[model samples]
Target: MKQAKTPFQFMAASTLTRICGVQATNISELLEQLRRVSTDSVFNHTFQSLSAYHFLTEGFSNDFAQWALAACNAPQMAEQLAALDIRQYESVEDLRADLVQTLESFVAAEPQRAQQKAFEPFYFCEAVTVTVPTDWRAHNLREFCEALWHVSVHSIHYHFVSARLRGPQTNDFSAWMEHSLGLPELADRVEHIDIYTNTLERVRQLILDECIPWVES
Candidate 1:
């Protein structure tokens, strides 16, 4: 059965296709997502929260800074948000308001400031997915499973960043991998693993063992 179309999934899909020629399901579907980043309240709040995290931590924490950059979704906004003093806002609400105001003013200042990049997702996906070990893509089952695990990690990052920017998501890496990466049987295998009951290593092993027949076929 075709899964129900979700507002958020389509929201993400439309944004990606319009900007990078990529969709949540495939790189070919080029529908325009109706939601614009500038008007997305949740995204703005994510930006504010991430900025505050960076500012409160004094930008000394690489992990916090990276999340802020991901939340920003653009180099220009990341640099601009990094320079702002978020502590002065005193509360998360204040900080968010200020962040939104600043972003709104920035948008007003330059209406044509390359807004096409707002919905881009592939670059972020590739950036996060590349953290896998160099040899993890070997043809062996163990390596293949490790590679799939890396892809799952990448999907988690992608979901996190997108959720922060777009709100909660109803999709998973399994369907995403099959639709976006063109790996159907592998995706079905991945979707069956229970991350809640099993450790990541265990889940990876399960996927590998289960996928052997698929690979052979």
Candidate 2:
């Protein structure tokens, strides 16, 4: 039987196809990849794997940032949530090397701004969570998993708002973005994503306001 795909799945698949030219079949494959690989590996492998996809879809000169954001399963991929499945990467070592190289290039390309952004908490968390070993820091599998969870949430909210706010509804790329963010049309714009943003805001408030503070206090 051909199972019906969810909104999130469809968006992610469309985003991948539009940006990378490779049809990932479903978001489940992407999520499974997220679960099984190390953070660094996932981040790096994503670029390496999708570069070919993008080359075929959009010419080489086109910016790859949006594709990266899309592949990261940003808010635009919301409805696609499915049961997480497990898969394995062939080379952890290679993944790490590629991520480090990518970071280096990013820094060299844009040193001042990149460094400033790197100092921010969320980016710091991302660096630590994804590229821990490069920093000569070691985290157990459980810690790494927790880090991936945090990064995934942050990345989704970031891209959904940023990307969806810019494009046309008819475009395959921009369609689900609005639904994912649940934004009210142009009249009322969200001021802050982490705090006053849709479901994420409620989630953050719950975790910070009720849960963490209560536990800490």
Candidate 3:
């Protein structure tokens, strides 16, 4: 009998989409289909969908992409995705999940910027006004993290933040929070929190506490 391939062994994004029967000839079209079936605007809102496209097309096979497409096209198969939660995995069993290696690499490579809430789901839900899926909770973590990363790290919101630092946007999640967004008072409270000197968890908490409240208003 043949053994199953691991998540790390998956093919590139373009190839995966084609194998899944999507007719797109390029990454952009593939993403459109992905968005259509998934019904999420987070990627479009951030414009980092292109960056993700570049990553998957080049060599990296995003585990989340596998689920995203599957959830959009074949909802029944999504239970497979649900079984492999990448939330706060701590050991071999955690890594033993289908997406274990990919999630480990992903979390390890996280900019270590924010106290990221490990994703619980593999699909999008928050920004959608449509009727929520019965399986929405299962895929919430992956989609939410993807959306948050694009907004906080890859999108024009992040770009504007980076422009103020006059450098790579990756370095200044805080600068933009202090200067551009709605939390000036909160920014003032954290203005002196040294990104280098203080713990990353602390910094992330400050940002989350100050920034997330504005989402409701």
lDDT of each: 0.37, 0.28, 0.31
Q: Candidate 3: minimum summed lDDT over ten consecutive residues — where? A: 7-16
Candidate 1 collision pairs: none
Candidate 2 per-residue lDDT, tens place, 1-217, comes to 1111223221111122212222222233333333444543443333322322321433221112332234432222221111111111234344444434444444456445333321112111011222111211112222222332344333333223223322432221123223432322311222222222224334333333322222233
Worst 10 residues of 1 by lDDT: 25-34
Candidate 1 residues 1-217, lDDT tens each?
1222321131111111113222322111111221222223323233323322322433322222233355334455545544544323324344345544545555566555524443433221111112222333333333443455555433332332233233322224444445544566666666555433444345546666775665565
Ordered list by lDDT, greatest first: 1, 3, 2
Off by over 4 Å in 1: 1-177, 180-183
Task: Please identify which of the two predictions, 1 or 3, would achieve the higher lDDT against the true structure.
Answer: 1
Top candidate when judged by TM-score against the true structure: 1
Pairs clashing in candidate 2?
A: 8-79, 8-80, 9-80, 20-53, 20-54
Q: Which prediction has more favorable lDDT, 1 or 2?
A: 1
Reference-based lDDT, residue 76, model 2: 24
Residue 50 miss distance in model 1 (angstroms) = 21
Number of colliding residue pairs in each model: 0, 5, 7
Per-candidate TM equals: 0.26, 0.20, 0.21
